[model samples]
Target: MMKIFGKVAAIVAGSALVATAAFAEDRKSYPAPKDHPLSEIISGYEFRTPETRALQDDDFENPAYILLDLGAELWSTADGAAGKSCASCHGDAAESMKGIGASFPKWSKERNKAITVEQQINICREEQMQADTWKWTKDPNMLGMTIFVKNQSRGMPIVLDNSPEMETVRKLGEEVYYTRYGQLDMSCANCHEDYYGNYIRADMLSQGQINGFPTYRLKWNGVGSTHRRFKGCMKNIRANPFKPQGEEFTALEAYMMYRAVGLPIETPSVRN
Candidate 1:
């Protein structure tokens, strides 16, 4: 009887060990190559080939510059019932918008949320421009306004201060980054962290940072916003895409900016 009791106890212990091991394996099943090393991850700009880099170097050649010029016109031109152009309130784009891109998806007290430059543009449009806000796909003007604003902060490092009030928002964003979704049962980290530098067909994956947003994509043949890329990634993994400027995407943006804190802002960057 004593021998039989000892045998039963040993079997239970072995079962417990097996269960624990399984749990651990599940937790680490899809990890970044270096566990998402902050120091080692390079900017997408760095991942570019010399030919692509050269294209981005010339302001005249980069196609995204057209939007920059348009944005300047939109900035100064008056519209809407208020007849208040962005310039009427803000004075000058260079002076008023400098380093502005680096500071957003910063916490907005009035909105009680993280707001991106695009969202801010619309907000200003309704309030300041007294005009309609431009949607992402239909209008090139949105891209124009966005890249123009981002260009002011070019070369400046991304600055995201996760304040005490914003702790929950940032946490939510982090959860979104790691949480698995879609048919592939993968998260952003699975691609950006785990598969960085790996080829997904012809394209090599980078850390998936948005420091170079309002970026020109060869795939799109046009400049796209950070949220546009987010939706694309979700769709690629067979997940339902979020609204272009939705709250969840804003949270994700906040977290991504944190992930890429200290990285230089490189607007109108070229990507394949």
Candidate 2:
């Protein structure tokens, strides 16, 4: 009976060791490679190749073009007791909207907080237009209007002002970008920096540029806003994602757009 008990203990210990080893192996197996390194796990999902770059520059139109047209109409149409069109308040979009997107996710002195582009739009709706606040993500008018507004600034260089006021917002964005989180225990840098250009099971990595967003993804079968794409990436990491147009994501988008300072806008680009 003593010998049998001893054998059982040894067997249990051995099994525990094997289990530990398996867990370690599983952890390492994340971001699995298609090749040893440098090869994409998804062979075709590589970054904008020169060919794709050309496509980004080409004047290929999208059915979603109508979305922008509608937004432009909304911008000019007056509403509420204020009897103010968005244009009546802010004037023509070119002068009124220049550098707005790039400068957003910035600190707002009036609110004493950071403000995203969406929030800025809402502020105008409430304070200037005396209009009801638009809901986020689900509101086609809000999303389409913001997208249209942003498109007006296409090709403008990201020009977020670096000031003492923005110091805290900038730092917070940097912290979020570098901190490891979720089941995979990876930061943005792990995939974008250390493993960039390497295959993760099947797809090649790009420089992780956000400049080309509101992109037309093949997987989605249509164009998607940057916030939508951001949620997908957060889901891939198994992290609980923030709401689209939420503060965290707004900060992240600002940071990422800053990173891709020179990459041109690639609205409606095809990607895997």
Candidate 3:
């Protein structure tokens, strides 16, 4: 992993040298909705090195496919008291799960709160499959299945819930995004919004988009969820991170998704 990251670091450093000349060319920004804060929205992919982008572009080359394959197998394998697999109820994922990834961090009327795709997966396990819920950040199966499910919706534009309840959640997320936290006294907007396209150490700041989540980050040497990245960012700021799948994170996800509106899903995206 160190060897791979070393190569990536070298490439990133080289890319940074010409970054000023290519800044506008490299960024792929879209016109934001009239109500959105920024005039344009940029995907995290824009900040990645060419090699990392190439990895995400090729399905076979993407390391995340290893976990995605496991998720596909698990989709058809029955378990728990019900002995029913995801395939049994959902039929083929390509058909049943299509366009589903873009509508995540949805409002749950039953729960009276917003829930992420990870939370929904656990809900299915406990309620539909009669199986124990997978650990949020610990279980490889959780991350694998998420990547698989979201990958089914690759290329679809994000379309989040806009109900009154969801609006409340989105507002909460907006608050979290702007609020300064930790010993560093920095908010998410400080880096992603204020310093985007600028090099911070060796890494280029992005718009903090979550559309490409369950992303395969080279820094991690593996695929990880948006929440995992969130915790890492909090740690970087010397802040106490929120627990995965918690209300705060769910709200934050909703806000990020809202920010990424109209951006195509790029699950299992490779990033450095």
Candidate 4:
């Protein structure tokens, strides 16, 4: 009788667990329409430029290119206690580092955390190069170096490797992507995916690609990093956004890059 009772209990517990999991899946939230100018612009139907049209080959010739050149020089120069250049460690980014930038915000088993490529760069400096780490978004050296490295992967598809370890980071990123926040109550996907190719005020919406980020924005009248673009979007939603280099932004970027998989990198892209 005890054995039979134990079996029944086990079956009941299994059923309950399954039910719980189903409920969790059903509650999964995604961005939806809310009353706001931005939200209306996103969901309202109107034509806009395609991703191909927003990009121009000449975009690289601007001042951003000059900064990129400086970054390359810094990359090859020796620094740190070991007197090793970033190149000495990572080797030629054009070849060795191809398709790398798009794979960032990966789960780090050693640290038991999700880490960004910027974080990994600093980690390498601290461990391999015996150098001081750069501030998250403050260090020009870090920004320049990262931009220089990312440019090496230009035209490569944004492919992010997935693993069990990356599940948490990916989920967090997905949550951010779909969750409505800020006073406007809008998410990234609401504009880019569901309402892509629509008009938002005078500006035309593209596919909202991230592979070409760290791009040149006509609105900014200059080239800016991906984080800058991110903050702008968040602010449009009226959300108190995190710092560009913070964890929230990192996860969001990871999610964006993952979605852009197979899309070629288009550094220094032009936007209206």
Best by lDDT: 3
Best TM-score among the predictions, by candidate number: 3
Off by over 4 Å in 4: 1-55
* lDDT at residue 236 of model 1 (Cα atoms): 95
What lDDT tens digits, residue by residue, belong to model 1 across residues 1-272?
99999999999999988875564343211122343345453678766667887889898888888888998899888888788888898898899999998878777899787778888888988987678878974368988888898889998977766587566777888898999999998899999988765668888777898888888888889888888899999999999988888878888988887777777788988887
Instruction: Report the C-alpha lDDT of model 4 over 1-272, residue by residue, as the tens digit.
Output: 99999999999999988875674343312232353122222111112234523344454444456657767898888878988888896778788777766666677889887777678878888988898888765356766777777788776656675887666666687788889989999988788777554357776564465665565566776667677777888999899887876777777787676666555665645555
**lDDT of each model, Cα atoms only?**
0.81, 0.64, 0.89, 0.67
- TM-score for all models, in order of appearance: 0.84, 0.73, 0.91, 0.73
Answer with 3 or 4, whichever has the higher TM-score.
3
Q: Please list all clashing residue pairs in model 2, or write none if there are none.
A: 39-199, 40-199, 41-199, 41-201, 41-202, 41-203, 42-202, 42-203
Tell me the tens digit of each residue's lDDT in model 2 across 1-272: 99999999999999988875674343211132243222212211235455544544554544445555667888898876688988886889878887676556677888777777778888888988888888765455675677667776676655665767666666676677788877988777788757665568886665465654555555676556667876887788888777887767777777665555434443334555
lDDT of 1 at 244: 80
In candidate 4 the C-alpha lDDT for residue 128 amounts to: 80
Ordered from best to worst TM-score, the candidate numbers read 3, 1, 4, 2
For model 4, name the residue pairs that clash.
none
Q: Which ten residues in a row have the lowest lDDT in candidate 3?
A: 17-26
Ranking by lDDT: 3, 1, 4, 2
Higher-lDDT candidate of 1 and 4: 1
Residue-wise lDDT of candidate 3 within 82-173, one digit each (tens)? Answer: 99899989999999999889998888889988888899888988899999888887478999999999999999999978899999999999
Clashes of each: 1, 8, 0, 0
